[model samples]
Target: MATSTLLLHPVRLRIVQSMLGHAQTTTRELAERLGDVAPATLYRHVAALVDGGVIEVVSETRVRGASERSLRLNLSRASVDPDDEALVDDERVRAGFLAYLASLASAFDDYLAAPRSTLEADLVGFRQVAVFATDDEWREVAATIRDALLPLIERSERPEGARRRILGTVSLPVD
Candidate 1:
């Protein structure tokens, strides 16, 4: 399966997002995180990703007579390569992008609805700013942001007492 095609399905995308930044994960954990998805459906999609080479099983163990697997994403295989002919499908890309946005919105909604939810106290932020820059300057800005974030992005272990935080970014140019 083409990388884009494999990763773009809404459910698969959610799986990938849940796995991101984690060094290893199991289907049981994924089921807990994605409570709305049926366990069978989640397992099926996970199997597909494994078969497609997008995620690999790192180890397996028997727990209570059932084999449990630990898996991680193949980051190199998680992205849509420019050379992939599948990139020509604008509708596919659009649908996937919409799915991504929808997931973020849903996450935000859940956060807001939770008891004792306070945006300021939680350090939550949602804002947009327009930037004027030439192509080279824009590239520099993006590179700077990535460089600053690489350390945190590469960390797989969470700190003690640290809660999970979501940070999402989207860039669009309008002439």
Candidate 2:
């Protein structure tokens, strides 16, 4: 499978997201966290990720007559290669973007299904702003956003008083 195809499937994407900011974890642990997904389905996607070299098994142990593997993303291969992106045609790019939108919608649905009071107390937000900027200005804005978020992304694994949050950004030229 192409790296983007392997990584962008909804289930696999969620699996990768769950692993992003943490130490190595076993498939059993992942299954527990993603309770909505069937164990077999989760295992199948995980196997595809491992086969595609996006994730690696860091360790293995015998557990109740089965081998449990602790896996983590191979950071080097976890993202689509820039060279590969250059080779992708426009249709592929649209498909990839659609997949991303679907995942975003699914996440929002899950959040809304949670307790109303809890959702209200959380810092969740969505907004859109139309910006008129030259290419250079747009690049500067992108860099500024990245700089502001990099520290928080890097510190995501902190154990104390830390909550997991999903941050999504999409920039597209207006027609």
Candidate 3:
């Protein structure tokens, strides 16, 4: 499975977020999806993802006299090993969680960049919290979170649609 890369910086994370669940995309298309990302940076991150196996070139064709490669997420190389204790460490997990936060924020920023005032937010809200719990209860709590949100995430799926907009946050300090 693909461990998140040391090179999976902000831009690359955005690229992957755009590419999720898709069959493939050309460099130009990816750049368009990732508005404000330079073509060169897109290509660089795509190459890194290819190396990382987070994405694979499903096909390559010459488009407009330039090489255009189609890309898709490769599940074969995508996962976080739950048993890997390092992934559970406070520092490493915090970094991974931060990466997730960056991805979610980037996705929002990209959507807002779209030329559509046609969209309206029917509701907007926020929550703040500090959770303290025993280790034995942590697994159950995590399970509750997944069970609660997975269906909400599923509701946003639309055929032939761009990725849905959903934000999630999870943080628990080691006290």
Candidate 4:
């Protein structure tokens, strides 16, 4: 139940993604949002996350003779530690990346299933460009992108006109 092991699982990763930057939420709520996952399966992953210290139960209430627990991601314990990252083998990295790719594909499928007019109006896009830069320059580019997005990420909880959007980026060097 190491943080990285817990996170690398596809279901658990999806659960973490759904809970990121949000307030406390119940397992029932999670199951609802992840409508494709079985309730039992979702519950099992939630328990694993809780046991792994990646998430915690913030509150509990009795409802209809059953206890409903509200859980929140423990941001401090939700990342692969730098040292642990160095220890991850190639197989593990490949597995994690595949899981992420599967999720991305699923998201794209969902987008396509939506109304075509809505999709077109939303300014959605997928594109890639090759940029040549020194290592230091690449680091600066990454930092600048993060700095520009940090405010939007922080304001995700705003209840106004904000809509959910997924932004995915991958940078790799070609041999």
Best by lDDT: 1
Pick by TM-score: 1 or 2, better one: 1
Q: 1-175, model 2: which lDDT tens digit per residue?
A: 8888787577887788777766578899899867888989999999999999988999999999999999988767777764775436777667666767777787788778876566547888889999889989999999999899878766636778776688878887997
Task: Give the backbone clash total of model 1.
Answer: 0
RMSD of each: 1.8, 2.7, 4.5, 2.2
Q: Give the Cα RMSD of candidate 2.
A: 2.7
Please rank every candidate by TM-score, starting with the best.
Answer: 1, 4, 2, 3
Q: Please, what are the lDDT tens digits per residue for candidate 4 over residues 1-175?
A: 5677888789988888778767678988898878999988999999999999999999999999998999988878876674775336878767877877888788788888876676558878888898889999999999999899878766636778666778877788975
lDDT of 3 by residue, 1-175 (tens): 2354422356766676776555567777888887687877778878888888778888889877988888877655554555655555577666666777877777666666775554445232347877778777888988898798666544535567444455455656755
Candidate 3 error regions (>4 Å): 6-8, 21-23, 76-100, 110-125, 129-132, 144-163
Number of backbone collisions per candidate = 0, 0, 3, 0
Residues 1-175 of candidate 1 have per-residue lDDT tens digits of 8888987799998888888778889878999889999989999999999999999999999999988899998888876686788878899989889889988987887787788557798889999999899989998998999899878877767788666677888877988
lDDT of 1: 0.86
Native-vs-model 2 lDDT?
0.81
TM-score of 4: 0.86
Off by over 4 Å in 1: none
So what's the TM-score on candidate 3?
Answer: 0.65
Q: Cα deviation in Å at residue 161, candidate 2? A: 1.8
